[model samples]
Target: MCLAIPMRVIAVDASGLSATCEAKGQQRQVGLIMLDEVVRIGDYLMISLGQAMQKISVEDAKQTWAYYEEILNFSPSH
Candidate 1:
């Protein structure tokens, strides 16, 4: 299964073909060619493999991040 992280768009290039996204205090350039809608700053995107898969609602993004945090904090007794 592939995991996609939710990131907020921080910047977009002049051509709109790429954007800088931030999540968990990290930033990365992600391709926007895969998305069908117009991307703008402050928009949340579902990111995977250096690409923006799609636009996601702010609430959805928050929920997904919360789930990720929960997984990261989980500890298994060995």
Candidate 2:
């Protein structure tokens, strides 16, 4: 299954189509070409498949992370 993770935009590249995002204390470059809203540093983006799909509010970011925490708590027999 694929998941869209909410990440905080830390830096934007000169090209405007890429950005460095921090999530879970790690930073990664993600594509911003797919976003409709103008992205800025400290913005929350919903990332999926290496791309930013949409801009989300801080509250939304918190909720998404809570969902991720829930997923992490799941333990299934492999």
lDDT of each: 0.96, 0.92
Alpha-carbon TM-score of each model against the true structure: 0.92, 0.88
Quality of model 2 by C-alpha lDDT = 0.92
Error of 1 at 12 (Å): 0.6
Candidate 2 residues 1-78, lDDT tens each? 888989999999988989999999988899988877789999999899899989999999999899889888989989
User: What TM-score should be assigned to candidate 1?
Assistant: 0.92
Top candidate, metric TM-score:
1
**How do the residues 1-78 of candidate 1 rate in per-residue lDDT, one tens digit apiece?**
889999999999999999999998999999999998999999999999999999999999999989999999999999
Which residue runs does candidate 2 get wrong by more than 4 Å?
75-78
Q: How accurate locally is residue 51 in candidate 2, as Cα lDDT from 0 to 100?
A: 94
User: For candidate 1, what is the lDDT?
Assistant: 0.96
